[model samples]
Target: MATPKHDLPDDDIEYVSKTEMKREMTALQQLGEKLIPLDKKQLATLKLPERLFDAILAAKKITANGATARQKQFIGKLMRDVDPEPINELLNKLAGLSDRHSAWLHRLERLREGMLADPKIVENFVNEHPSVEIQQLRQLVRNALKERELQKPAKAFRELFKLIKQYIPEPALPGLEASGPEEEDEE
Candidate 1:
């Protein structure tokens, strides 16, 4: 059996090789495909080059699978010409924000569960979040607990989750806060 030739010295071999380069390009192509599903506004947030951005928009308009695949390949080629590091970084940040949002939601679920399990937890939550509507929250919790005991439809339970979510402060998506209510008022 023949051994593969090393293009760089043994120490430098740890760096990127031809196989790695191909893998990176494939990954970039996959990322481009992922971007295609995003709306135009979301794509604009990525700060992509005008040509690449135009290609992505054009790609989104294609209905044929074969043409879309070809357009994705073209986007990958364009990705190679631009600096992918910043693009990857921004993607990672967005992913991290999504993870944090999920975690925050989970925390709210746990809090709701804890409140249902112990009456004291309700007092504690009310104390911590004084701005919360105490009477409404207590009513929702009582109704949810009663529904659980009776095995009725979980309407109250769902409402409790909605109320809990309202209390939890969520981080806004990038580029959205700027154009929110304040911008509308200015116009």
Candidate 2:
């Protein structure tokens, strides 16, 4: 295949090619799809144009596969008119937050598992989190272990996770702590 001729030398031309533009639009549409699954509060944080926001809301309501695909293409077209850099940045931040939240939850799960496997861990946990209710946590752990042994419904096991989440303060994300205390003052 022959290479397409450029009007000027590659270095002289500053504009993106048609193919590159199409790829960018496609990427933005995929970003829009990701945003669709987010709740209203999360979507509000993006600060998208009114028309584009309405389009996303409408696209989300579309259940038919063919129509949804078509709407997504339309959204891509709309995205071409808007600056995608900020949108991409925000999406990356949100994704990072989700990853951090998942890691935090996994850490809690491992702590719970460790406590259950070794009763001694409970003493260590109570010592670390002095505000935690020791008796309540111990009772829950015991019940959770019994539930696991009997292969019954995991009610106590789930409760143990909830209790752990409540008692153990979430590790603050870097850079977020600077603005942390000020947020409470605004409210």
Candidate 3:
């Protein structure tokens, strides 16, 4: 086999092997697949390009296996131009699979348990987060305990966790800008 002639020197020529290119495209396709099931609220949070977002939405509507696979590959081609770090971070967060998010959830679980075990345990949260409503927190703890005793569905139990999550927000993941509900444009 003869090598193709080129003006650039061998060292100046940058070539990506077919194997590596295929690997990258496969990874992008997997990422795009992950985006397909996300609800509108979750998808709106990402800074995805319009074309890629539309492709994801379209992929959601495709029911045939072959068509879905081809659409996913098309999405991979579009992802080549987009940065993926933020998307991965947000997806991890939504899934609650990130280390920091797991720890945050565990902490909230512990807090919920403490509140259920002792109503006075809420003072800990009050001291730590002044925004917590004392009455609401107490009511939820009471309702959760009642649910536990009565062996009913954990409606209030889950609500108790939501309340804690609301008052004590998750810390921002490293390398991502943290935006609070009240964030304003800086001068």
* lDDT (Cα, tens digit) per residue for candidate 3, span 1-187: 9988989778987899999999988998888788899876566667678998899999999999999989989999998997788779877876657787778778889988998887567887888888778888889888989999999998889888888877877787655556443221111
TM-scores for the candidates: 0.64, 0.59, 0.70
Clash total of candidate 2 = 0
lDDT of 3: 0.80
lDDT at residue 133 of model 1 (Cα atoms): 94
* Candidate 2 global CA lDDT score: 0.73
**Candidate 2, run of 10 with poorest lDDT:** 178-187
Candidate 3: deviation at residue 146, Å? 6.1
Question: Predictions ranked by lDDT, top down?
Answer: 3, 1, 2
Q: Which candidate gets the maximum TM-score versus the true structure?
A: 3
Highest lDDT scorer: 3
Off by over 4 Å in 2: 1-15, 45-55, 58-74, 77-102, 168-187
Give the Cα-based TM-score of candidate 3 against the true structure. 0.70
lDDT of 2 at 86: 55
